[model samples]
Target chain A: MSQVIVVTSGKGGVGKTTTTANLGVGLSKLGKKVVLIDTDIGLRNLDVVLGLENRIVYDLVDVVTGVCTPKQAAIKDKRFDGLFLIPAAQTKDKDSVTIEQMQDLCEKLKEDYDFIIIDCPAGIEQGFKNAIAGADKALIVTTPEVSAVRDADRIIGLLEANEIEEHYLIINRIRPDMVRRGDMMNVDDIIDILNIDLIGIVPDDQDIIISTNKGEPAVVNPKSLAGQGYRNITERLNGNNVPLMDLEGNTFLGKLKKLFTKKQ
Target chain B: MLDLSRIFGRKNNSKDAAKDRLKLVLVHDRANVSPEFLQKIKDEIMQVLAKYMDVSDGGLDINLTTATGEDGKSRVPAITANIPIKSIKQK
Candidate 1:
């Protein structure tokens, strides 16, 4: 069965596009046909992040306006097979597409793709509503910051009000060192507030920047800690029981020292 | 041993402060009610209760909380009011 999931963050610059791009590539790498829909309208970055900016012949506005079909607007990934992107138009504003049109587009794409991941724009505006119109589930992405978490909480309430119950959480850009020093919120602290099922926790890594710049998603790069987290998320989405990575686990010597200190 | 540092310490770290602030803000945000309005509601409730009974000035509290219902699914927002009454009026 096909699943239409909307990846959203009410606060901007919380890695919504990066999460969408990486998740699309990660699922496609696992042999699933995935199509990513960028609904950010004017400020389009999913195409740039996926490194498919040069091949965009048509955009979502073209499809919504009936100027072209979804298949024609979708650009196939250069690296991962079965991965495609329907980029948003840079010229048009968010009001260009309505919720009904987005739902219709997703309904048509659901037949061809195994997963339709819609990258929603920031804020609870018409753009956000349009992106989530046809989604069966939602993945709320939030950074470990007060502003992001606050917006995430509001997004969760809005999703619930809209009757989107099959929603989950993904706490992105977690700084374990800062968390250890009580300088940043930990995973448990976020879960305690959001009170949603966690699909993944991506650690803060510089590798994401390099990969995004190269137009390659970090999920395909085995060396990236963030990539591993995304891969684990893909596995969980596929119904596999993969334990979350120990992003903040102490070293063996550190654990032994703690044990000795306790004994003393 | 009474640790002097514990008695006069920098009370909260930034992370804990963030969590505390989020907790308070989300309760109000989720309930679609402001803290000041909650306090107003608490005051009204106490006044209504005091009409038939002697209500205490303190210990009257109202809060928006999240608790799981009987369905075992997820947390639902709840309004809890606790008022301390001294005595009931004799009719």
Candidate 2:
């Protein structure tokens, strides 16, 4: 069965696009057909993340406006099989696509793909509504910051209000060193505050910067910790029971030392 | 009022400060609490406090805030009202 998941974080610059790109790559690596739709119109970046910027002949606006079909607008991933991206328009307004069009587009694509991952824009605006119109589930992305977590809580409420109840959390950009030093919010604190099921915990790895700049997702790099985290997320999202790979334990000072001592 | 710095002392750890703060923030956020909601709460509190003693209406200060318990591990959202007692009333 196909799953339409909307990846959203109400606050901007919290790795929504990055998560969308990598999860698209990660799911496809598991041999599932995946299509990523970028709904952040006029500020499109998914194409650049997937290294398909130069190949976009038609965008999501074109597809939804009936100017082009979904097939013609989707750009296949250069590195992975069964992975495609439908990028947003760079010149159009965020309100260009109606909710009905977005839902219809997802429904049409669901038949041909195993997963339709929609990258939701920042804030609880019409863009967010458009992205989540046909979503079956939601993956809320948040960093270990007060602003991000607060927004995640609000987004969860919005998701529930929209009747998309099967929502999960993905805590991104965690710093184990800071967490061990008692300076950063750990995974448990965020999960406890948000009160949601965590699908993955991505560490703050420098490799993400390197991979992102190269237009290659961190999931493509086996040595990248972020890659492993995304893979674990894909596994758990696929219904595999995987123990969380967070660097800290339930207690602050005890288990965190053991986990990081081995790494250092 | 939530004494944020004390809860974030080295022994308490700074991360807990964030968690506790977020807990209170979400409670207010999720409840859809507004200035008007707090005013309504304060108004009801005033009616109850008036029965026991005379309270200085001008000095009344009420708002929704957080307080860390004695354990310091569990922080909860609370409604605080600072009503100055003007005089005692007896039956």
Candidate 3:
């Protein structure tokens, strides 16, 4: 089934873009045809994160404005045979594209791809409405910080209000060490407050900076903890009951515990 | 070894504190209630209570919080007000 998923967080700089890039690439790596849409508009950066900045000839605006087709704007990622990205325009803002245009774009792309992941812009504005218009599911991303969780709560409410019922939470940048020391919010603590289902728990790893620096996602690196987390998320998204990552020490016992604590 | 947590006023885990604060803030956000609206509600409660009892306004604290349902898994918006009553009139 072709699924349109929107990656969003009400607050900015909370790993929405990173999760979108890594999840899209991870699904492609797993042999699923995937396409990512950078809906951040004027402040677009998904292309740079995917290392396709120098190849964007046409953009989302051009496709929506009839200047070009979705095929022309869709940049084919060389790393994956079935992966593509529709880069957002750097000069035009969010208002340039309406919600109807975005829906039409997703409906058109759904004919060719298995997954269409839309990278939503921060805040609850026109950009957010446009991003969620065509989405069948939503992935709410947040870090362990209070500000991010608060914004995430608001986003959840908005998603419910918008009638997007199939939503899941992705807690990104979770620090197991800080969580163990009682200095950061753990997965249970966050789920208790947000009252949402879990899908992904990405740890804070240095590999993220290294990958972004190289314009590549961390999911390609098997040794990277963040990469493992993203890969697990891809499996879970595919309806597989994979065990969660043992974030404590990444040991054999942690893996055993993960088997018993598999979340839906 | 000496314990400095009590001196620093951290008797509970910081993550617990963070979770508690996050929940409290979300209650306000989810209710879409501002401090000014809360003050208005408090003032109205005081006006109605003044006819029957002497309610201490300075020490009164009114907040928007969550109320769990019978299942305890479901939650809804609830107004929690703690008012210190000084006297009551015979009615």
lDDT tens digits, residue span A53-99, model 3: 99999999999999998988899999887999999999998899999
Better structure of 1 and 2 per DockQ: 2
Per-residue alpha-carbon lDDT of model 3 for B1-91, expressed as tens digits? 3323234324587888898888778878888898898899999999999999998879898878888978987777898899999999888
Model 3: lDDT to the true structure: 0.90
Single out the weakest 10-residue window by summed lDDT for candidate 1 chain A: A255-264
Cα lDDT, model 1, residue A159? 94
lDDT of 2 by residue, A29-87 (tens): 99999999999999999988888899989999999999999999989886799999999
Relative to the true structure, how large is the alpha-carbon lDDT of every model?
A: 0.88, 0.88, 0.90
For all candidates, the clash counts are 0, 0, 0
| DockQ, candidate 2, vs. native dimer | 0.39
Best by lDDT: 3
> 2 or 3, which is superior by lDDT?
3
The predictions' CA RMSDs to the true structure, in order, are: 5.1, 5.2, 4.4
**Backbone clashes, candidate 2:** 0
Clashing residue pairs, backbone N/CA/C < 3 A, model 1 = none
